[model samples]
Target chain A: MSLKVENLSFSYGPRKALDDLSFALAPGSFTALLGPNGAGKSTLFSLLTRLFTAPKGQITIAGHDLGQAPLKALAALGVVFQQPTLDLDLTTRRNLLYYAALHGLRGPAARGLADEALATLSLTDRADTPARNLSGGQRRRVELARALIHRPAVLLLDEPSVGLDAASRRAITDHAHRLADRGTTVLWATHLTDEVGPTDRCLILHRGRLLADAPAGQIAEGTTLTDRFLALTAETA
Target chain B: MTPDPLHLSPNIPQGGPGGGARPPGPAAGRYLTALGAILHRELARFLGQKSRLVAALVRPLVWLLVFAAGFRAALGLSITPPYQTYITYETYILPGLLGMICLFNGMQSSLSLVYDREMGSMRLLLTAPLPRGWLLFAKLLAGTLISLLQCLVFLGIGYAWGIRPPLAGLLAVIPALLLTGLMLGALGLLLSSLIRQLENFAGVMNFVIFPMFFLSSALYPLWKMAEASPALARACALNPFTQAVELIRFSLYLTPNWPALGWTCLATAIFAAAALYGYDPARGFTRAKG
Candidate 1:
């Protein structure tokens, strides 16, 4: 397993946020974590990223336990937070280089890797542009590019397509799929079923419990994804 | 055709189940690079913000030029240890104003930290693969560097205003200023961990900066405050800002104030430790929603 969460539980004071959540991701696999708003998806992401510690659970990333070896676990993981994390004042390339330096890559090594990542994302043209100048899609692409600079083993993007137009959304979704195909274990969290492919592994979470865990097509049964998702969440809603 | 950037070659280590892809574990070279990167980012931000520099200077300049000039006569001064001869009130408050520069800059850095937390940039920083204490210290050091620059600029301006300490005294003050800057910046870092929202920072400025500045030796000597009220004088003596100002004052005259130096160092260590604890994932506000 590239990433594993075993019996994770967390609470925000008296209110439980995640309840006995457990899952594991193999290397090179793409998984879609589908959940409605307030279904503990963000909470799960927070736990996975170690933004908040799981009061009861074990999270192992790339063979390193997050609680035991946080630096190693975090080094193998890449993240794009739900909120915009880019420094708007910095150019796209500068932002990438800054993240590279954070991961102990600098000088010519960092610059060359940054260029390759930019080129891979087809963001080379916008490399010199300040993040503020780029459109929403471009900024998201830059963030994805930044996440790839260190070649993390596991990539986690939380609602990365939020607020993007349809075309940009599809482009970003396709790019994530391509990344998973290239052997980067990816966990893309979103409320939108359209982002999940038929062949991808899908986890449906509702009210802090895993409702379904299987291939996207199997999870849907005979109905469409939208129908199955609504059906699964409707009972709790 | 170019290989996909996301593709891993067979030669590269895989972090699979029991895979031998150990992280570049705590290398000194990596730690230095991270520290340097963090410092560089801060320096770049400071240089980019002309308004921040102007805002930091305006308060101290106002106190020195207008408030000092107006209060010069009303505030009578006795010969203090750092002072051998009778000096103008502006001369007396020069060190205090320098302290003011650092105090305000410290809070300003704290305010930015809160803003960064809100904006999500802080997450990028906190997730870096380094010791959290070292990262926080790097942040404190970065803020202190900016404080030092502002102090130098203020000193240049004070020279123009005709308040001249000895050249040796000026050189001696550098270490004092550096220590004071770190102490105050650490206090700010601790406060940043407490302040959850950017809007709440203004309240901190009024509640913290005002009380710290007014209750300290920044504006008046502890002896002067004692004459007015023994209780308030005790409070002033205990204010870490008081020791910081006194340290700067003694250094300005090439005199060593051991007590003040000791007090400031103790304060820095305590504040930095508390800040680290506050940022701890299990205990502190970092767990709270940004």
Candidate 2:
């Protein structure tokens, strides 16, 4: 497993956020974490990325224990936060280069990686343009490009498509899928069921507990994934 | 069971910061890189809004040129370390004006953190692969760099107005500015992580900033406060801003106040630690919805 989380638990004071959650993803697999609002997806992402440490469980990224060897584990993971992370005043290329530098990529290597990542996102033409001038989709793509500049083995995105238009959302998801296809383990957190296909692995979470983890095809046997999701969460409610 | 058909490529091992070919020491190099990125972003943001630079400069300039003019006679200036003889009130308050610039910039940086949280960019920053402490420190360093630039510009303007410090004093002022900048920047980081909403920040500025500036030894000497009220003098002496102001005032005269430096360093450490704790995922302020 490229990413392994076991018995993960977290809380915000009195309210438990993630409850004994355990999951694992192969080196080159895409997993969708499906849940409604307040289902602890964000908290889970925070724990996985080591934004906060969980004393109750363990998280290992690319064979490195997150708690013990945070830098190594973090170095193996790339994260796309729900918020737009790019500096709006900087050109897209500059933003990527900045992120690249953070991971110790400098000189020609950093420039080359920034260029390649921008090209991968079809944003090479917009490299010189400030991020603020880009459309919502373009900006999000630029963020994705920045995340990939380090070429991390594990990519964790927290609700990457929230405010994006349908076409843009589709493009972002497709791009993620392509990245996963190329061996980057991806944990995509979202509530939209349509974004997950039947063949994809899916985990349903509700009120900070894992309700089910199965193939999307099996979970949504007869009805739509959305319908099944609503039914499952409603049953627990 | 059917095989999971979606095959991603093999995990490509890429060199990360302080990893690969880089020799490891204290990880300062990695932190410097992160700090560089954050500083670049901050500078870009400050420069992008053409109004911000003007506003930052204009506020202190008005206080120096106009407000100081009105009070020049009412406030009698004595020979101070930075002042040779009986100087105008305007000249005496130049360091205070510089302090004010740093104070405002620090608070403004905090305000923007709240704005960033609301806008979602903060989330991106928080989730970066680096340690949260390093991230927050990077932010502090960035804010300090900007504040330092503003102080330099303000000093240049002061020179234009015929308020000249010792030529050697300019060299000494850099370290002073850096210390003041870090202290204020740390306070700003603490506020940024603590204050969840932009609306509530105004209350902070009203209650904390105004009092800190007005009651501090910024506009007047501690001895002056003592003449008015011993209690007020004590308060001014204890105020961290007073320490910052004193540090700058002495350094601008090429003098070092060891006590002031100690106080500023202590305050900076406390504030920076609090900010880090506030952003800590375990027990910090991130749990509350921004």
Candidate 3:
């Protein structure tokens, strides 16, 4: 497994946010972590990203154990958090360069990677534009470019498509699939069913446990992913 | 599974900051790059927010201009070690007000940390292949640098306002100002880690900043406090902030106060370590929720 979570459990005091959840993603796989607002998907991402630690479980990213070698694990991982993380005053290229430097790239090499990332996202023209001046979708794309600047092997995006228009949503979802196809392991967390294509892998989570883990078409009892997701969550309730 | 070399993008340039074959973990070169990047971002942002610079300078200016004029006749100072002859009350309180600049700026830095943590920007920072301690230290250093810049501005304003120290005194106070800034920045780092949320800064401002500033010898000398109450004098003397102010005060007159330096450095080290422990992931630190 390129991205692995084993027996992960978390809580806010006594109330469990995640309970014995376990899952893995193979290389080149794009798995939509489908869950409702309270379903602990963010908790799982927090654990995976080492923003928060789980007492009971282990997280390994591209063979590096998070507990034992966090730098190595994090080196292989790229994250697009649910919230907008860009410094509003900085240009798009500046944000990517900053991220690249954080990952050990610098000077000419860092600039090259920044150019490549911006070019990959078709944001080259907007590279010098301040983040606040950009549209919501453009800013999100800038964030995506920032994540890619260091070329992390495993990408984790929590609700990356949220707050985006329909066209922007498709562009992001399509770009994520393209990255997966290029052999980067991706775990995209979102509640929207339409974001997950029929061919992509899926994981349905409720409360704390993963209720379904299969292809999007395989869940829902031969129905649409939205219906299947609703039914599985309702059944758990 | 190890990260496949083939999976590494061709767009990735060959050499990292280390200038040779890449290591799998955080390297010293990586640390410096990240630190520089963080500092650059901070300076860039700080420059963009021109009002912050004005706000940081204005508080002390008000005190120096208005309050100092009001209290000029009220407070009289004996010729201290740094002061060979009689000095105005404004001259006596210059270093104290500089300390105030750092104190507020440090807290402002920490408040941004809390806000960043709440807004999820801090998560982006922490996800880097770096130790949390180093990152926190980088943040402290950045805030300290900004505080130093503000101190320079305040000192320039002071010189213009006829509160000029000796030329040598101005040069001598840089190290003292730096040490004091670090100590206060570290203290702010500690508080930001312990404080529950961003909303609690109001309490920090009133309860922490006010009490520390007033209880120290910032506004008045410890001797003045002694004249009022021995207990208050003891509190003023015992305050670490008092030590910081004294260090700056003596340095501004080109004198060294060994005890003050010792206390400020010790306090800085202690606060920094506590902040590191507070932010350690093994402790299962709080994750800002939606």
- Per-model interface RMSD values are 6.0, 6.7, 7.9
Please tell me the interface RMSD, in Å, for model 3: 7.9
Ranked by DockQ, top first? 1, 3, 2
Question: Which regions in candidate 3 have their CA more than 4 angstroms from the true location?
Answer: B1-26, B288-290
Query: lDDT by residue for model 2 over A1-237, one digit each (tens)?
Result: 989999998877788888999989998789999999999998888778665678799999989998888878887778888877777777898888877767756678778878877777777789999888998777777877787777788888889987887666766777688778777888999999988889889999998899989989899988888889999999999
* Two-chain DockQ for each candidate model: 0.37, 0.32, 0.34
lDDT of 2 by residue, B1-290 (tens): 22221221223234331123232455666667777878877887777787888899999899899999899878876676656678887777888888898899889888988888777677666765578888887888888888888888889999999988887887798888888888888888888878878899988889878998988877888887899999989988999999998889888887778999899999999988888878887766666762
In terms of lDDT, the best-performing candidate is 1
Q: All candidates' lDDT scores?
A: 0.86, 0.81, 0.84
Worst 10 contiguous positions by lDDT, candidate 1 chain B: B12-21
Candidate 2 vs candidate 3: the TM-score winner is: 3
The local lDDT score (0 to 100) that residue B22 gets in candidate 1 is 26
After TM-score superposition, what is the CA distance of residue B214 in candidate 1 from its true location, in Å? Answer: 0.4
Query: In candidate 1, which residue pairs clash?
Result: none
Off by over 4 Å in 1: B1-26
Candidate 2 Cα misplacement greater than 4 A, ranges: B1-28, B80-84
Summarize candidate 1's per-residue lDDT along B152-252 as a digit string, tens digits.
99999999889999989889999999999999899999999999888898898789999999999989988999999999999999999999999999999
Tens digits of lDDT, candidate 3, A56-124: 888988889999999888888888989999988888888888888888888887897788777777788
